[model samples]
Target: MAAVSATVILLIGVGVPVSIVAPVPQARAEVAQEQQRATDPAAIRLPSFGSSAVGVVGMPGVLAKRGPQAPRQMASITKVITMLVVLEKRPLAAGEDGPTITLGQRDVGYLDQVIAANGSWQPVQAGWRVSQRAAIETTMIPSANNYAETLAVWAYGSVPAYLDAARAFLKANGLDDTTVVDTNGLSSGDRSTPTDLVDLGRIALANPVLAATVRMATADEPNVGALENTNQLLGTDGIDGLKTGTYDTGANLLFSATRRVGDRTVRIVGVVLGARDHPTLDARVPAVVDSVVAGYHDLALAKPGQVFATYETRWGGVGRAVAAKAVSRVVWSRARVVRKASVDPITGGRKGERVGEVTYSVDGSTVVVPLVLDRDVLAAPVWWRLTHPLR
Candidate 1:
């Protein structure tokens, strides 16, 4: 017989009692990351010319930029900003001609300055009565330099005041790289980059009055007998209303277009500067637009029945938590897809019960998915209930 320590308690009953506790189950979850697609800048052929710049921006931050940040002479593109600033201060109501302005000798005097300086002009007569709408068309469409100056002086009471307002407008809109000394963009002093112009182009398109006026090939006004749009590319390849500029420095064009991607229309804006001539500048407009629109495609992030988590028990029972269905999203090139998952600590769950959740995010957009059990995870069996470790 073995000797027993006095400190050790011995059970003298016919059957020694045993206490067993059911095992706890641990949750399991993992992120299944999807491979991201690639976008080659060279895939979209851009124009190679003297100091040219280009950029594209769309919904959900689909942005790609190229070319130098240097400020080039904006030429007539300055008129685009002139119109925008005017609209911001004096918004025209739908089907309304806006407030009336009687043309003074000064407005006509400015027309004489255009003639002496050899700037483009629409026929203007002193004491001519006109609505604000006609002046907007007379400013944007024919690229009329005198009407531009007239409209500016009318809006701000002086050319210096208008320039001050233009600078303030540029600063408020985050166009730090742009500066304007004139509303007509005739002077080499007016400067901006393709990136800034692209932003300005979008702002112009948002205004229905400005957008509609630019789309017209020609407009017959009471003061100006006939006015023709300088943008020949208007209404071509989804190209609509925009501004065109030509100067001793270089030619400039700010273009806006919309293309259908799946069930959505992706609005695009292209800015090209420093081309050889107007036709050469016009040719690259569609290329800049097509390159951006072609990058759209629907992407799949997750599939149905994909296991995202699991439930395991010490008693040898397990169940998988899976995605109930597939997930897809509309994305542009170089967009990223990321996932996060969490599982609840469940001792047991019936088949198809929810255990936790998973979230997928990309480009400031997110989608949540539920994690359901693939099979039932029952409590410990009778044998396990009797044979588990005693506590």
Candidate 2:
């Protein structure tokens, strides 16, 4: 009788706890996958003339390129650099016109100077007072060469000083292929490759002042009245604010557009340099944009209530870990997608309890989906706990 009593105590002390509190079986994950597919670059409609490049905003590297990679004449697009450099010294906030400039004789002389040079010009009168925003508006909206120089002189006190600052800005931004010789691109000295121009376009779109100003179809200036925007592509297919350039070499356009891929909005930046004419540049730009947009698509990674892992216990309890909801991601055509699963050990749990997660990643973007039990995992029976001492 004493031996029986001792056995009972030992069983209660060790067997009961081992069965009730010992670690349960870990869930094993099983994943289903589909082969990844790549987009063909040959399918993209790249410009046949000059140099061109396109890239999605926030992603590194150029998505597509054509023509020679060497730097080419960029024409009026040089105004973009001037605007950025000047604004760096004189920052303009959204909805604010910034400081005012009083037009003097020398400022008025800019009209004749640019006119004689055969560059674009907007009318300015001596003693006319213009706000900083108005000056920028006059400079960019009409691609005015005179105001570009005027703003450059006003911001830096001389064209030479502005040139020094512009060079520094280019270097600091890693635009080694670009060179700025003047505030307006009228000088053959202003040159940049399609890749550098694409990066420059990205920078311009990042600035609130420039981004807002470039989208206007027309802006009313204090002295110049209403000036029309040179970028005729604005407002078409979501093409927004950006700069344009025309020179003896060829016409160039640094453009930005937006499109919807899956549930995400994607901004695209592109540049076409050394086009034969403005008409050719305009027609080619939209085609390039559409082709780039076509390269992005939504990939289905997982579906709702699909089993990813299974849980089996020594006590005969069973459960399945399933995705709680559907998961999908938007990715470029060449980007590769990968999946991983993680699960935790569990003895038993109520239905719909979260147990694990699955992650899908592509090109630095990631999506995580929760895994839950599809059925209840009941507690082990008392008989099993008492009989199985070491489990």
Candidate 3:
């Protein structure tokens, strides 16, 4: 009987079940996925530009969806980088003269063919010479490939050397995604992104000489009859200068505009790559600029503690009091507002005393400042109040 009882007890203990740990609930899994989607690059719907699009308003705001990662064949827009590289390495002072380039037999032959094919020409005769300024004007204004090649050869002593410099410049400027097979942007394989072009535009505008060249309506080359700027926005209100590019792949435009708002002057740069046609870009570019301006206008700078009408706190001896003034100022984007509150101890705050902190969030960024007790609370006590307290 004793053996039987021991065996039964052992069987009962051995058969007892272990508690199973439950898996995370399905709802929690769904929540986690939603959070991931918010930050996932693949999940977001970026705007579709055949190449790319980037528009910056003011100093720190980009109003457009920077598109997907893809290789794009940028046409003449490649010249923007060519110009940038040249300016950085060889800065020309105002009215500084450039080395005169006399046409080689090969250059002369090419110029004649290009001039006959299209009225656009750097117009170099075998013996004719030109200035760097004239060459730059032709290259930037009319997207002249002849002048681009000529300048490349003159500056670096060979077209290959000039191309090496161009690629090096692009890589140094955070335009790693770009590839330049040629200096003139004549090759369809020469590619870049709208993001890259916007950066190029920003760099180009920093050079006063380059800026002036792009803004000219027409320039006369020593031997080249005349070169006219193809960018129509030069004379337009609020638009000064920029470059334009087009090829069978698509049309690209880099537009820089300046507008005065009150005492502040704002410069905006817009890049649109791979439009169906020139007309489409002509309409879309201005709309993008208008959107950026509108978005910036809606942004506001808030005084600290504006999120709460009043904050009330208790004092052990003085009873309840409302904070008199807000803590600090906050600048926020036009998007939704988020507020957070905390407390700090000031000079007068006893243990556990409440000084205040208010945080305001704008466009995913936050600014936090302090709030202090009103001055009236610190005023001297009144003698009449001490004597008449009973009443």
TM-score of each: 0.75, 0.88, 0.65
**Candidate 3, pairs of clashing residues:** 327-370
Best by lDDT: 2
lDDT of 1 by residue, 1-391 (tens): 2446322445312112342343433434344444344432334556777444444444422255556658888888999889888877788987789999898889879889888877788877777899999999998889999889988888888999998999999999899999999879878889988778878877787788988887888999986788889999987888876888888656778777777776667777767788779888887778777877677666666677888766667777778888877777767766766778777777778888887777877766888888888888976665665554351
TM-score of predicted model 1?
0.75
Best by TM-score: 2
lDDT of each: 0.77, 0.85, 0.60
For model 1, the stretches where C-alpha displacement exceeds 4 angstroms are 1-42, 57-68, 206-208, 215-227, 262-264, 303-326, 343-354, 363-366, 372-391
Instruction: Rate residue 274 of model 3 by lDDT.
Output: 76
Q: Sum up the clashes in candidate 1.
A: 0
**Residue-level error in angstroms, candidate 3, position 322:** 13
Distance (Å) between predicted and true CA of 249, model 3?
A: 6.1
